[model samples]
Target: MNNNSQSLTYTQALEHLRAQALSKQSEEEVPLISALGRIVSSDQVAHRNVPVADNSAMDGYAINAEAQSASGQRFPVVGQTFAGHPFDRRLTEGQAIRIFTGAPIPEGCRFVAPQEDCEAEDGFVTVTRAFDEDSNIRRCGEDVRAGDTLVSRGTLLKPQHIGALAADGLATVPVRTPLRVGLLSTGDELVRPGNLLESGQIYDSNTFLLFGLLSSLPVNVTDLGILPDERDVVRERLTALQGTFDVIITSGGAGKGDADIVGQVVGELGNIEFWELAIKPGRPFMFGSINGCNFIGLPGNPVAAVVSFLSFARPFLLARAGAPFTEAEPVLLPAGFAIAGRRPGRREFLRAKRRFDGAGGEFVEKYRHDGSAQISSLTFADGLVVLEETLTDVTKGDPVPFIPFSQVGL
Candidate 1:
């Protein structure tokens, strides 16, 4: 077995994975209402007119701008225009129409004065304020032009995107189908929860943790349950699940142990592209392919598994699912408390809770416990305070880069 232990840096590993994922998958058309959280496979161009036709912006009188004066000009209200109704009547030099919000602007009128600035008497209306040209009138193509691109390709469809498409009269949108993934766990000392744990055996938490994480993504996940640390069983399961899922994610058994068979199985079944990373706690992470299905081998430690999945696997899955390229950009803020001791060459993500100081200033304070196996650290943290690979010491007043979990939809 070739044990080329030259590990890849975090940036290099991400670049390699992105380069390997060159195949663009098929797309499907989904209803506008059901397209939230889905990625658009194609550019969404406006098919019909936006605002559909000329409409009102407010519940006010639609009249000629030149007809109103400072003292007040009164004109008889010939007809009324409500939403979904068009006044075919043409407004003469001194004539005006009573209009509601979203109603089409009547012909021969170029301006609309809001109702608050106007007073209605008997059958006439008086404008007390000077109305500007095109005031309160929503033009036919003001929101969006015909044939304009409402949303570009690779955009993750949010509620705002849906509104934009709906305004363009699009009832359905074309989006990429969710990627299917197969999940597995390997460890002889691991047992599922509710089962009896013998002396040294530990309850398996990686499966549930991974399942919860995968559930939030735009992917279809198939749980392969737990597999023992035997090479043959691992190979058998990999062979059976081949061609069914786009990717396979296995936790544990990537380390250099006698029973660690994931690296060997990846090499035997397919190409082992990379076996290790330079990141802390997740240095033994592995990436490869088995029978054309991508495989990721994560560390056994619960916190390390979640970190690796979030930093590396999540982006790849999103890109394959047609989401736009998104990076975990950090926000620089002052640290609330002083942190002691730091490694110089490797980046560290310390769990932190965000709080506002007495002066109403926001700050992130590091948690007390930061063990790799402490899953509760992540649950209690609002974000991660990133200590750069170059910085060896940090003071309380020093600026630090932090990434909030909420921004990434975690």
Candidate 2:
């Protein structure tokens, strides 16, 4: 935290929180097959080249393209190669080797004539056009060299990364240890998902939303269940979680009131950077540290909790997990409908689903209802049409920044 003492913007807060996370995270060795979504602790250098040798990209005939006749001509098939098998004999002049995809090209072969481009017979093939050198041939070390860096440090390993690592014959990978996160939803009116709800009580959805979001990351989650809106009890429960979790997320009591005691207790015990943000459905947010653990307090409203957690907590957690800090890049989409009378100074994340036009182009149709308490909007929402804080009325066909649910876990 800087000494300026001014309230931070959403971007500034994100930068500050990320700056606090790098070294406190730990590293571990994990099985390669199970490393998806895990952050890489260090750069992974390839032990061996992918393909390991010059190979065929298609089921074709390997021939020395330079040896072909100027007008292109027939060549006798000398030997055959299959995947996991290679023709060891040197390819002779005026001869072609039958090779399957992924089969290592024989010595003296410089090009591959795809089967579709060649007329094949019992033991010979004819080409009407001269085969280009290196065409259809996957060169050795082409995809990855033996000493190339496969995955860099702080990389969030995707499925493609896993495959690349496996190509180097690695059985395990070095990754950061999963962030230990404790999730607790507050409010006495909240009930367990499986339990019967009374007239005044409702089933807890924030926890599920948080869980699903966390499940997509590399984290070990401990659900603290629901906490009643008692100040003392909230403080006691929070104290118990201290020193046990890397981060604690609480969903209620972040406002300014005796009933909203989470922020008060956090401020008393540690610090609260800024609890009130100028963002719709996610204004009452708390971010600070306590007992060596980071804390984030979100608003009690269902949609608010979801939006706040995604917008703020996720970046902090990813930085702590040693993953690269990637801000969600927005896509410009055409508004399917017009919106009016929106207030300024607070960014609005309007719920929207996909709607295709006559030309099959995708556009966004904003949901008519914008209540934070309406949890169903989270389901109907395929993306968020981010209307900026300074702007107001958005007419049809206007360009705006949009983010799909897939970019940030639901």
Candidate 3:
């Protein structure tokens, strides 16, 4: 619980936010069909081995590896095994069984000779060449053993994971319940879209922007609408939301302006763990708690709101929802532009588009404007170019860290 005088480094603040994740962890069992995008609550072990039996991996003739087979040697084909059918009888030396892919191999069979490598005539197979040793057999438990962990706890379930769980015959899985998140936007000069705007009033796009971002997350979001700059109204609305939400995210009123009463009221109602960050476009960001619910206040500028949310709020919320939090690893690429006459001491994220040269070289081109209020820059951007705090100037072709929007689920 500190004020703006104790602004935290990005790494320090993220560590602090993720440390509180376990306090909000809870679990529920859901059908496998409904488990996509949900976090696993515990390790899911395989109940049975994949390919429960040793099966043929190709359409071929299953024969004993020890059989005396040569170019002119012929063996009688006694049985046939399809995918759903199996040859129950045992195989003897110099005997061959016709088998298809996924069909269980007959007893005493150690190799499968591809049908193309042998000649079949009058219920007999003639080996055209030497036998391959123990080939084309999918062994039991090769993919998954009964006691092996199929998926670890805290994994964000994806399609491949669902397939693995299905292979183990799982009808239901245990996952963390979605977090309850509330969204609030504060500004007196803001008006909702589809409404006529008066003097000095602009459409409130932050509500939709934050709503779209929250919709992609594993949380149930409730839109609390917009609040004016009045301190009493902001406090009243925030007070009513204290215990109902797992986290309350508010945009605007986090700065020191006269109208920025949201952070002030939050401090009075609960605790402001940190009120500032050492980063450009999000320096006014705030994180705290009211009653038992967590709170995050974002800057009013549209682009700043986005950067703060992705860099801080997204990871924190995911961690609290039983998923592990890890910082996004940036890909280093050369800068397509130059930076000069910029102050140091704060990390900055610039909206950028990646360009590739004809010879397979890649670089990042930053948006023309660096203002936090430039919302159009985000639309044209494919990702963010990260400038270190100690970096004062960046010449064209200098290597810089870049993080694509897809990496952060944007």
Q: CA lDDT of each candidate?
A: 0.81, 0.82, 0.88
Please write out the lDDT profile of model 1 over residues 250-338, one tens digit for every residue: 89987766678877887788877545776766777777777778888898999889888887888777876777546699899899877
lDDT of 2 by residue, 65-183 (tens): 57345135788888889988878789876678888999988998878888887888888888767656788888888888889999999888999999999989999998988889999
Best by TM-score: 2
Candidate 1 clash pair list:
none
Instruction: Give the RMSD in angstroms, all C-alphas superposed, for model 1.
Output: 2.4
Query: Which parts of model 1 are misplaced by more than 4 Å?
Result: 1-3, 67-71, 194-198
Can you write out model 3's per-residue Cα lDDT over 255-321, one digit (the tens) per residue? 7666689988998899885457889888888888899898989998999999999999999888888
lDDT of 1 at 329: 92
Candidate 1 vs candidate 3, TM-score winner: 1
Off by over 4 Å in 3: 66-76, 113-132
Quality of model 1 by C-alpha lDDT:
0.81
C-alpha RMSD for every candidate? 2.4, 2.3, 2.6
Error of 2 at 260 (Å): 0.7
1 against 3, candidate with superior lDDT: 3
Model 2 clash pairs are: none
Please provide TM-scores, in order, for all candidate models, with all chains considered together.
0.91, 0.94, 0.90
Q: Which candidate comes out best when scored by lDDT?
A: 3
